[model samples]
Target: MPRIELKTKIRAKKEIVFDLARSIDLHKISTEHTDEQAVDGKTSGLIGAGEWVTWRAKHLGVYQNLTSRITEFKRPDFFADEMVKGAFKHFRHEHHFAEVDGKTLMTDFFDYTSPFGLLGVLADRLFLKNYMKGLLVKRNDTIKEFAESERWKEVLSS
Candidate 1:
């Protein structure tokens, strides 16, 4: 499995960053370039523990569907989601939030085992890892944009 960890500093409260991280609506906005959509399950609002979401998106010139469920959650702190059904053999994404000097320190630990064994490993080493990291970076940038401004109210207060 390949693990990609990312830490992003946001000039906002942990509560705001946490909620934005779980916001299905904000996700769509961040991934508009990929035309990502919540096709089933919790399609909107903040996703809580045990809630699953099916996402449809175009990536690398291919359209795919992936469903993931939140296995663990702690408000304004941490949460973990695992793949229920997806292209990958298995995957787990953990979101962590901490307060630092009155700001929020958000971190993502994304671990996944791609299918096709050796081919997958090669893919990760060649380009897939960077592709996934880019996606996460885009999403985090979106969350930071919203959390640091009044824009977050639109997504969280819906």
Candidate 2:
């Protein structure tokens, strides 16, 4: 398995950052570059424990569908979502939040195994790992942007 961990500080409350992290609508906006869409299962609003979502998106010149479910959750603190079905052999994404000096520290741990054995390893070494990290970074940047600006109300208030 390959793992990527990252931490981002946002000038917002943990609750706001947490809610923004789980907002399906905001996810769509963050991944617009990939044309990602939430096709089924809690396609909008906040996703909570036991909730699942199916996403369709274009990646690496191919369109794919992936479904994942929230396996664990603690409001304004942590959450884990694992892949239920996807091209990957397996994947689990954990989100953690902490309040530090009145700011929210958001952390991500992404662990995944690629398919096709040796071929997958080669791909990871070449570009897949960086690609995955880029996606997460982009998503976190979006979360930070929304949480720190009035733009949050556009996603959270509705």
Candidate 3:
């Protein structure tokens, strides 16, 4: 298994940053470059515990569909989602938020295990880890941008 951790600071409220992190609409916007779309289940609003979402996207020039469920949730603080079906053997992503010095501190912990045993390990070491990290970074950057500006109102209100 490989674990990727990232910390981002947003000049915004924790509540706003938290909501933005969980918003399905915001995710679609963040991944627009990848042509990611929510094709089923809670496609537009804040995803909560026990809720699942199925997303289709283009990654590495291939189209893939991944379904994940929110296994844990704590409003304005933390949440964790685990892959129910996808290319990986397993994957779990945890999002955490806190208020620090009047700013929001957002952290991501992503853990994943690839299939094909040793071959998969080699792939992870060669590229998958960095690729996954890049995706998370892009997503967090979008959240920071939206949370810090009035643009958030557009997604949150709808």
Candidate 4:
């Protein structure tokens, strides 16, 4: 499995950051470049534990669908989602938030395994890991951008 860890600092409350991180609408906005959309399950709003969402998106010039469920949740602190079905063999993404000196610190732990055995390992080593990291970074950037401005109100209120 390949793992990606990212930390982002947002000048906002922990609860606000946490909610933004779990917002389905914000996710779609962040990945707009990929034309991602939620086709089933909780397609919009804040996704809570035990909720599942199916998303269709274009990546690497191919359209793919991935379904994932939120397996764990703790308000303003932590949440985790695991893949139920996707191109990868398996994947898990965990989000953690903490308040430090009046700012929110958000962390992401993303682990994934690609399919196809040895070929998958080669792909991960060559570019998959970096590609995935880039996606996470982009997502975090969107979160930070919204959390730091009045834009979050639009996302949260929707």
lDDT of 2 by residue, 23-87 (tens): 99999999999999999999999999999999999999999999999999999899999999999
Tens digits of per-residue lDDT for model 1, 15-63: 9999999999999999999999999999999999999999999999999
Provide the global lDDT of candidate 1 against the true structure: 0.96
- Give me the runs in candidate 1 sitting further than 4 Å from their true place: none
Q: Give the RMSD in angstroms, all C-alphas superposed, for model 4.
A: 0.6
Candidate 1, residue 143: Cα displacement in angstroms equals 0.3
Lowest summed lDDT window (length 10), candidate 1 = 98-107
Q: Residue by residue across 1-158, what tens digits does model 3's lDDT show?
A: 89999999999999899999999999999999999999998899888989999999999899999999999999989999999999899999999998899999999999999989999999999998999999999999999999889999989997
lDDT by residue (tens digit), candidate 4, 1-158? 89999999899999889999999999999999999999999999999989999999999999999999999999989999999999999999999998888899899999999999999999999999999999999999999999999999999986
- Write the number of the candidate with greater TM-score, choosing between 2 and 3: 2
Q: Rank the candidates by lDDT, best first.
A: 2, 1, 4, 3
Which residue runs does candidate 2 get wrong by more than 4 Å? none
| C-alpha lDDT of residue 122 in model 3 | 99
Instruction: Please give the lDDT score at residue 138 for candidate 3.
Output: 96
Measured on C-alpha atoms, candidate 2 has an lDDT of 0.97
Better of 2 and 4 by TM-score: 2
Residue 96 error for model 2, in Å? 0.3
Alpha carbon deviation, residue 131, candidate 2 (Å):
0.3
